[model samples]
Target: MISGLLLLVLVGSAMAQRDLSVDCGSDGWVTVHWRPGLGFSQTLDQSKALLGTCPPSSLMSEDTLLFRVLVRDCGFIQQVMEGRVTYSNMLIYARRPELPIITQLVKCDYDSPVGEESEFSAEEPDENREQETFNMEIMNPDFSGPAPSLRFGLGSSIPIRATVEPRSHRSLRIYMKSCEFATDADIRRATQVHPIIANAGCLMESKSGNSSFLPRRHSDEMRLYLEAFRFALGQKIFLHCDLEACVVRSLNVDRKACHYVPEKRRWTLLDEPSQSYACACCDSTCPRTGLMIDGVSVHKVLGPLVIVENEPESSGSPDSRASSAHGMSASRVWLLVFVVALALVTVMGVLVISYYLCFWRGGRLGYRPSRDLLTKY
Candidate 1:
């Protein structure tokens, strides 16, 4: 509906089969405009409930069931090989709960654009660079800066904010596809990696203790809470997240960052309310983006965050500390005396060795008599 790059969708009669209208919008969301009347009304396939899912916004369209889903949220299978990435997913209309009646398959290539120029480049494309209007930061609860040390106070939350400067009236809907913490700035060569967000914005619940996307305040910004971590000898830490923007009027909460909160015991939407239905795919394998959204998809970085182990705490009572200091000074004096004595011994030994060598060569000429021996008596 919102103007998009009319994707490979050819809406057939009764939704026989068609490519979804894919729009890589400036806001980052890969809006897939699906055709109507997929015949969910006609099918009594109870098993269909278990097969796949659609975004809450797309499915409940009065009865047509013309579905929409963050392709990565609805059982989309992704494959990468030979400098290409492919996403595959299907829709099922079963006869009974199990018997199949009709099935439709959809596939999207990240590199599959209308033009023949489907090349991959390390640098971002010019148009995508122009659309990027966002910033990633490490901040506190009140959104105050001077970021805290990574060692203390558990961990910190990162705010990735987007502001349309000329201030577009369009509601800015942001979705994070995935995020990873890497040791290297160049993601392609990162040695150590910890994926805190994956499966299209699903937090690594069990892996990262309290890492989750916090509820959003304004549509302009989103926050993520990373759990406390300890990695010593860390050179540089970088948090990289792939962000998408939807240039639409209403809130597109269906496909934003989601996490399962243990305290509340519920799945929460990162940008919207917690009563989530579209987030069901977050736990398992979410759908994959069928359309190439690189134009609007922006990967943000907040780093070299510098998460390191805490310093060793100092211990010792005041009186005992004074004693320790006194003892340390005494040890330093002893060490200095020992060093001086050893140096004199070394010099004396060297001179004696030289005299002995001379005496062996030229008898008494090499050695002068002691002072007592030199006495006239």
Candidate 2:
């Protein structure tokens, strides 16, 4: 019964959507729209979708894109379009954005180099370029400015801007590979193994700084917006990004990768540069996700990296098979007491009835003694 109730709640809590269109091609684009309350039409983009953008390469390989849009706005898009607009051969996902933000890890499609390798926004670059290495800087969420520390409560959206150095007057392309919630254990395990977990959720990709100065060596920066509401109080967050400098030998090459350096106490270039990661990093499974941590099995459904407090020791145990003695629960003990009291009451009532029938009503013992005494008198 409990399982059924849980299933119902899960289904009911699912995000609702108005499917504008069903089938979409890989190379095709999708136009998503939503009406939150009355007549407000919400404008959406590719970054809000689960699979991000499905390009020609993806559709060609997968045949068709199984697409669905959120029936409301998710508070990610800023533009407003009148009603919902439909495009030729494009998929649609429209929904209301009324769900609470939590530490949720949403599944996203894998990153691929599908689009043409050109300057972002179609501006041609000069032939003579001689910059070798570049740097990435996160411009948004400001990182407490000079303090170099960042702290935010739940339900806060983190907008990331990673700028490349040598400054390309044009824009630079940024590709986000993965984003996930992890603990110190998970991070440690992942570092030991090559290639991070591929199936992690909340993936996004976009271009940045297209309309900057020209004749510069650096490309445009990459911007990533992450909405964190369901994260644990102190859990670590990890982000991975790949920056493409240019298409070389039919490949998108990144001369310098970017990641947060722990030892330096700042986000800078190191031997192992990742897209982004929190200070308290881990790579192990959480105990509440039905995984055993430190030889303890946890059966509860806690969010990612959530700390379990006052947990039980062996919640369900069986040890009374051989022995006759078994501990009774509180309810069982109360039931036993009630049954014994009822049995005693029934026995007393039967005894009273027998006494009335034999001694009082039938006069079996009283009449003989009285007759002998009266005859003597």
Report the number of the highest-lDDT candidate. Answer: 1
Each model's Cα RMSD: 18.9, 23.2
Instruction: Quote each prediction's TM-score.
Output: 0.47, 0.24
Query: In angstroms, how far off is 282's CA in candidate 1?
Result: 2.0
Candidate 1 lDDT, tens digit per residue, 1-377? 22223224331124355334444443323444443333554633233332144432434334333444453455444444444545444443323322222334445556432223323322234553435476666654445553444332224333334333213444566666677878888888888887777767677743347556666776656766666565424466787878776543222222456787778565566654522433555554544434333325677887776544433111122343477679889999999999999999999999999888776655855577688877857
Give stretches of model 2 more than 4 Å off.
Answer: 1-148, 166-172, 179-181, 184-219, 247-377
lDDT of 2 by residue, 325-362 (tens): 23346568889999999999999999999999987987
Candidate 2: residue 347 lDDT (0-100): 100
Clashes of 2: 35
Quote the lDDT for 28 in model 1.
24
